[model samples]
Target: MKAAVAAILAGMVIAGGVSAQTAAPAVKEDFKPSSLNQPGQQFPQVNSQGYARFRIVAPDAQAVKVSLGLGGRGGTVLAKGADGIWTGTSEGPLDEGFHYYHLTVDGGTFNDPGTLNYFGSTRWESGIEIPANDAEFYALKSVPHGNVSQVLFPSPSTGAQRRAFVYTPPGYDAAAGTRYPVLYLQHGWGEDETAWSNQGHANLIMDNLIAAGKTRPFIIVMTYGMTNDARPGTLPNFDVKPFETVLVKELIPYIDGHFRTLSDRGHRAMAGLSMGGFETKAIAPKNLDTFAYIGLLSGGTFSLEDVNGTPGYKDKVKLTFVSFGSRELEGNRAGPPGQPRADPRVNAEALKGAGYNSAFYVSPNTGHEFLTWRRSLYQLAPLLFRD
Candidate 1:
């Protein structure tokens, strides 16, 4: 159990933020407006090689910098041209998928006017998408889609009405008697409930997966993890008991009562990313009779000892899914002498060898970001609710 907790902490530190950019030998000239740009605006462009170019109209500002590329160098600094426009290209190509960034102009932070804003880093920041090779899996297609409806449920524990987004699969309303399994999904720290649908495209991923007949249709419930109270740098002191009560005690019952859900331990699962994963680790193992399947995406892993220590984990838990970005694993691969690293993959293998249904995944060429979590969900959805 200590090793699993250590691995979770290590993952939080090593894989929780922006990745360092790698330098490219040459820049390509085939830059195009990013798909995430404003309707008619053009400026934040991405090239075929994933290099991002920025053009900001901050004429009077002494300097402009973008908070998107190359760690240790602060960020990419933009140069002012005669037209009073600041322009610059990233030092190298960025990783594929969505990235949250803001402009630092004369020591003031702001969002770029050209691109659309996304809620991240606890605020609305400019977002850009570097096209991915496997992007088609989550792409918008002509296939039947699901509905992501906003639901306001009573939370007596929190003394307020909490908001959650529910994703009902295609034909959910049309099929009268067919009840679906439910997966309670969660987001990372410094993010809200919208991160899973807006930033991660979780609904689209499920839509595509179901359209392809790859996975069983299920309902997904996403709500705030009640983490906003934890201000910058005081996360370790944050308490989970309050949010746990809101989720396990209040929200789960509300969802079961309202939605046409298969309300049983075998049909219900819980998974989260980053700190949300930490919450799952803290909550699910203790409430073994509530959640049968568990997943941690770029979150943490379960050691054999951790599983053995729990009272009914081996008998009640159906699946233990753990995932990380390939780069996140690289960051946790080594530790100083006498301090052995707790490798999540090694822990997963130990669980499997001990006659447990454990699965481990790594997103290629990514870090602790939305793309990693997106791919993790893509891999995990098929393995859930197999009964």
Candidate 2:
């Protein structure tokens, strides 16, 4: 049970969510405001080296600390200056991509007033972006865009209206007779349907890929994965039945009925990140008739024996896509007590050797953060529905 809980929590903070490092070279002078900062807010800045510098104004506070740092400091302590502004820089560089952080001002938790807040770690957190080398793939480009519309569908099983965001590719409505494939994407634990678009930039990634003719246009659906029930102390006995019913029995039918979708199994796919990836592994493989392509991003890995045990998976499944950040490979890869750690890259190779359309990817210098997922989606989108 201890190992099980460890495995479950690993998805939440793989390598400690932008883990700290030891000493580093002298801090460079090329600091600029983060791209995610609010209008006219310039205190939270990121340098080219991924080191974050924070400035918080607290005239009378005893101590102000930003919950982003390196070298096991747990956070960066700001020193108050004559101007009453507390400022400090991270000990070393942070991981490239999006990270959720907060402020500890005189022992009180507060969100940074300078940047946008994103839902993470079960609450709204201040988001910071360390510019990535391949950020262009998910950047807002001058290309055709997709519409991410909020959709509320009835859920008789749950006796409430569940909400989902559907991303219809550009020119979807303009092309009336044309139909597109659908990928039922999910968010990680403590996140809602908004994470994919707001943080992960799913729509923009797809737009860039489609405009470049790198991928076929498809509809992407994102919804709450019902993971709130799997909170601390309850995760060991977590069940996927509630969400499976809402998705397979309720949501899928509504999407097909309302949108111009290729409603067959071959044209459908499911993928998620972290705990969302775990949910995909739980729900997609068991219902192979509903999902043809499966993607797990930093969720977990699947072995040959596991696939062989799943009924009808050999004949019904099309693609098994698995990916993780390079940093995650250095962290805990263990499974529940007796189960051996299955190297995901090796498993991908094994699946390929057995005539399965398996693909694996690793984001350079990242952990289980949004950058890895963004890159994974960029790579996975081009390979989806290639037939």
The TM-score values for the models, in the order shown, are 0.94, 0.95
Residue 49 lDDT (model 2): 87
lDDT of 2 by residue, 1-387 (tens): 334344646545553244455556788989999999999998699898888999988898999988876622478888999989899988778888898889998899999999999998788999999998888999899998989999999999999999999999999979999999999998888888899999999999999999999999999999998887567656757687899999999999999999999999999999998778878988999898899999988877777986988998878888999998887776454344345556889999998999888899998878778998999999999999988
Q: Pairing residues by index, what is the TM-score of model 1?
A: 0.94
Report every candidate's CA lDDT: 0.86, 0.86
Superposition error at 2 for model 1 (Å): 9.5
Write model 1 residue lDDT over 1-387, tens digit each, in one string.
334434444554343233454544678899999999999988799999888899999789999999875731467899999999999998877888888889999999999999999887789989999899999988999999999999999988878999999999999999989999999999887788899999999999999999999999999999999886676446666688898899899999999999899999999999999878878988899888899999998777788988999999999999999998887777544232246667888999999999999999999988777889999999999999998
lDDT of model 2, residue 21: 54
After TM-score superposition, the amount by which residue 353's alpha carbon in candidate 1 deviates from its true location, in angstroms, is: 0.3
Stretches of candidate 1 off by over 4 Å are 1-23, 333-340
lDDT of 1: 0.86
Model 2 misplacement above 4 A: 1-5, 15-23, 71-73, 331-340
